[model samples]
Target: MTLDLYRADLGGRTREWLALHPDERRRRSVQACATKDVEALWSLTEAHLSLYGGSGLLASPHTFSAYRTGIRQFSQYAETQALNLLRLTPDDAQAYVLALLAQGRKIATVRGKVASASALYKALRWAGATDTAPFVGVRVPKDHEHPLTKNPPYSAAVLRRVLGVVEERLLSACGRERERLLRARTLLLLLAHTGLRIQEALDLTWEEVHLDEDEPFLTVRSGKGRKSREVYLSDRLVMALRLDRTLPRRRSHTAGMVLPFRTRAAAAKLLKPLFERVDEQGRVRSDWRGCHAFRKQTGTRLYEALHDFAAVAEVLGHADINTTRAYVRVGGRRAGKVMRDW
Candidate 1:
């Protein structure tokens, strides 16, 4: 086996694992290299994983993890088909697409996998590891262009309903549970009013908030791509945040964050009950669920009020105005409003 050909290219953790399991590594490498096609596929995937881990393509850890999973899943699928990376064809790529569809994967998930796999192949071509780019310009299935395009934004009344329910629950709870409800309520308000992503809110620290300022805003230092932006808070949101700051602590907070959770999972656990209640009571007007829907709602409201895509993009901290457009989903509403007013 030519394990030495790519041994140095392994990511830090992969290399460490290989070092710890010398016999297993030897066995796998031998198995991978026993056949010409087998060695080529294994080497290409390892190289892809190595490049992906080091590329810093996606900034958020959650996003990076998803891309990694997608790539691994595609590689496994390719292996099952006895595909060779060096001699891949567009037909092979289409077969994989069909296979994903046959497996009943969601359109979004299938698209993500295809994108990740295509990107990996692009990287391999750029590195001069592959002779041809098979997945280049491959099209995913129809009606699966983008996830946000399919999901309509939640209504303002639904946002108010979510907040009202949380407030009502807070009034009846006590002790640690009360604090949990309070945190959930504050998060819901912030998401609805501020247009901040849930992760940005979860990672927000007390020090990042400037409630005493003339115009209160949060300093999002750990935003996507580690980019920093000032997200202004509404008057009511500022007041709620201020009161939350002064409230007595129950569970210990980590990273000095405003919320008790240092991770998304913990925050999900805290907010699940409220979301379930929302689902049970049919407060949501659309199929779009989760905290991110609040971001879309805020973006829609801002676009409606400001009528400036650039300004809305700036508020949402979107690197691309097109992404902001997707979030806002303005479509013909603005034109209709102008026509009616004129």
Candidate 2:
């Protein structure tokens, strides 16, 4: 452990009587850091969490797995720096960027490095290296290439059909797997319908969902830049959540977190491939579609249905609406033409 930010902690299992606790599950990520040396071990854990913590690329489901590629790339460039701590200066940062460039990394790949590296410097400063910032004067070079698009949200009909099939499969699942699958399906739909980042959706609990109304919304304690927002849910989605949550949650397994899946990693594993089984042509696609693609698809819908950037941004939990707008420019139009106008 290296962060020591968690108050009460355990691995593999939480305290007695706290089973099925969604809060404890969300807390588990910080708990892994319960034994960490926060000040000294500033690079790996601190830098990684900051990027995913919603600080810079706020509301993005930033997995360290998504980042490992960049770290490995930077390490190769680190050898080019001849013994300088990779976190010490712009020279190191620039060299790393050049290495990525020389390797023909995409702009998105390079952007990840810039964001991750900046977080590392901030973490170093947070760890008391106040005089240093490895990113001073460094910048993400303007990407003159094609703009990045939001993966269009699934069509209303596709969203309906896939969910219907997955729910059928879920209800028919035998034994304990049912509850787990149910939780995963519920969370997956919630992610797509509401446009929550994976971390925000992962942090949900039965309590945060208000099922009393025809339309339900989830209230999440926002991480990343420390902002929270209330996200609305569709009526159909709300009914699904209300019905599924009616089960006496397995008290022996939960530790106060909202949903069944605890960590983002666990949620990622549990929730992916649930409903994204269909492709754009209404055909059964591969099972590789992830939680993020759902969020992206939601953005796609906003561009088509409302054509409002702010609405799409609000749904996706982005601090800046431009982030949502960019998606419309890049991906949503194609999605619109392909999905409906065609």
Residue pairs with backbone overlap in model 1: none
Q: Evaluate model 1: give its lDDT.
A: 0.69
Model 1: per-residue lDDT, tens digit, 63-116? 555656776677677677777755779999888888999999877778888877
lDDT agreement with native, every candidate:
0.69, 0.59
Off by over 4 Å in 2: 1-40, 43-81, 86-89, 119-134, 144-152, 155-161, 248-253, 275-287, 329-342
Query: What does candidate 2's lDDT look like per residue over 100-186, in tens digits?
Result: 778788767788877655664454343343346666677657776544332334456766776676678876797777777667667
lDDT of 2: 0.59
The stretch of ten residues in a row with the least summed lDDT in candidate 1 is 33-42
| Model 1 vs. true fold: TM | 0.73
Error of 2 at 136 (Å): 2.3
- Candidate 1 C-alpha error for residue 217, in Å: 0.8
